[model samples]
Target: MAGIPHYYLYGEPGAGVDRDLLHIEPVRDRSGPNDWRIRPHAHPDHMQVMLVADGGGTIRMEDRTLAVPSPGVLVIPAGIVHQIDFDPGTDGHVITAALPCLAAAGAQDPALGRAAGQAAAYPLDGSGVDVAAAIEAFRSLQREFLWAAPGRRAAIIAQFSRILVLILRLSLIHRAPAIGAADHDLLVRYRALVEAQFRSHHPPAHYAALLAVTPARLNAACKARAGRTASDILHDRLVVEAKRYLIYTESSVAQVAHLTGFEDPAYFNRFFTRRVGCAPGAFRRQAAES
Candidate 1:
């Protein structure tokens, strides 16, 4: 499959830059000359935060387009296809940070890592401090990133983490049927485990053992946080990877099956059919045609 352009911020695609670094700027700086519109694109391993002070527009994420008004925040997680159009004269600060930076900062705290993985957009509450703090955080980041003074990089990274904390707090405050801390943590752990072991086709019990939790407890957490069981989570992850392979590669069905952890093509076909509502070949054909 064809690849989307990769860049360090809004600069030219494929520019050589440190993978663990970040770029900070105002939305107007980049969007002004381009009619305030950005076409759909994917960032391979970068995360973005935008603090809009006034004005608004729409966002395109995958197959959905969302209306976004000003006085809000936008969090774009890594690897998602997204695009944004700013209203003319919109005012905002955009903070683009490398995923590795957040990962390193959160190495000892799984909750922080989990927060960095969320993608969302919503208007800030009028009486809340989140919007103000978020805007100032990005401004500080931009100054530190540009000044290159003593410990500039360290200061910028610290500001990045601080911004993430504020955003996560805001998310919790605004999300409905708020997730309990324990349930959120468990779901994050499950997602991380799935990322590491989905290729192995490990059972839910295996994941629970690795997490040092009982399978029943894990299932409870998944059901509480996501309305799905742990087993369903694992199966869904497997099917997602399988669909990606089938759509993006020239691999045959058997090859795709093996690559996605099914050694038996027939079994893989059935699994895909059950979860994805179609056979693998048919899925591939439909995706290609679309």
Candidate 2:
């Protein structure tokens, strides 16, 4: 593995975009130039929301590759290593917003925040959402993003928030009815905590403590909402991050172990093999070959 490219936008290498708050453009504007294939990359401080209006392809986030449905929405959180292969002439809009902008929006609505943080695809065909209205919203957002009019920043935020709220609704509609609101909310908070602390290798009890709940309560909530125990959620997050490091960095296996919070390289190797069915070195070699 070599160093993965970190870009402000897909192919643009820079600290940040000029607009700073948000950037909107047709998917073809960037993907078309690269033959509709975006290689694996990460944006350190930006998240992306892509609306695929026509055509479809596959998106790879870390080790998982999922097909993109036409007339769907895709969310990519900041700092995630992802790639997208779009069908030629795929028509859609991609919205790139700064982390601060998302944070501000999330401060107002936690559900929206959670939805944005997750990387997912929501097909709008049978989602009960007004597809035409959603497209109009994207167009309005792109217009505001391009114009140098007064109150441009606020308008962009407003439009972005609207899209997020729509995504949230779609997520809720698709979510299992078995999970109650309180359990869902707790799961959301638990996920947020995992994202922040996964690299530290903390136990579930540590997270439960931070969330002001007992470990049993946290585990139950996680089981109800995510179909995993709280410990599983934490360990799964750790494994995902470990896979990212192995696939994206040229660090030695031992170094990768320490970087992912393991003190003993042998222990890390055993852990990786147990969960992933291969040693870290083998995993990296396989990824490179693929």
Candidate 3:
């Protein structure tokens, strides 16, 4: 871990590695317009779980975008390209964790499948209240663990498991029985590809070449099904990961710049502030204090 690069740690065993027994959960309500409408992006090795507390919108993936109504939740697996646009009038909470944590929770645990593979991505039908309750409890525990104790990792995992199970109980969408398995598989694969490559090569053409499809064709599929352009998804994906690295790692701004594929750390700093409303270091300092 000491010698291996962090990029290789994408879902690997090192810093930010997924934990079966440790989860840092957050809770926010009416938090103003912040971290909402997360850009399209992918996690090379982590999965994200989110619940819609109010309103309705759409969630775009590599191959398809699904309509999301309030009282719903979602599980996004690692290595997928996707983005969420909350209903302009809606507010919600999101829980993101590494996939290794999901897997470590035994495959048989309903939450694992609800958050690990295809069956797990879209789980919210009308469970917003429950999701909110679980998240509230999770957040409470997180705050307590942070301020009061040093060894509550076990308790955190147990509580998080309850949250996942609540998410899994929501009724799933019944997509047509006609969508061929191959197409479904392709959709999943395309998302995974975007997750792994969005940071480096962002053009749809580059991705189409990897997928062995024409850029135009890929664009059509993404637009028609996912409700957005491939370029949009690609850029959003890159930015989110960049934000995570900037906020969570102790690496210097220059180093975060390099890790995010920026040729110049100064330019990266400018870009980060422009989009995020603050300089990378400033945001890091503020987040640390919070």
**Which candidate leads the pack in lDDT?**
2
lDDT of 3: 0.56
Alpha-carbon lDDT, every model: 0.73, 0.79, 0.56
- Give the winner by TM-score: 2 or 3: 2
Where model 2 places Cα greater than 4 Å from the true spot, the runs are 176-290
Residue-level lDDT tens digits of model 1 in 214-271: 9999998776545568888788778767876887689999999999888899999999
What does candidate 3's lDDT look like per residue over 64-140, in tens digits?
77776556566665445665666666655555565444544434564344334542334344434455575465556
What is the TM-score of each predicted model, taking all chains together?
A: 0.59, 0.61, 0.46
lDDT of 3 at 84: 64
Query: Pairing residues by index, what is the TM-score of model 2?
Result: 0.61
lDDT at residue 150 of model 1 (Cα atoms): 81
lDDT of 1 at 275: 78
* Candidate No. with top TM-score: 2
Q: Per-residue CA lDDT of candidate 2, range 93-188, in tens?
A: 998886557755566778898778677777889999999999899999999988989888678889989998987887787761221245555776
Return model 1's CA RMSD, one decimal.
12.9
TM-score of 3: 0.46
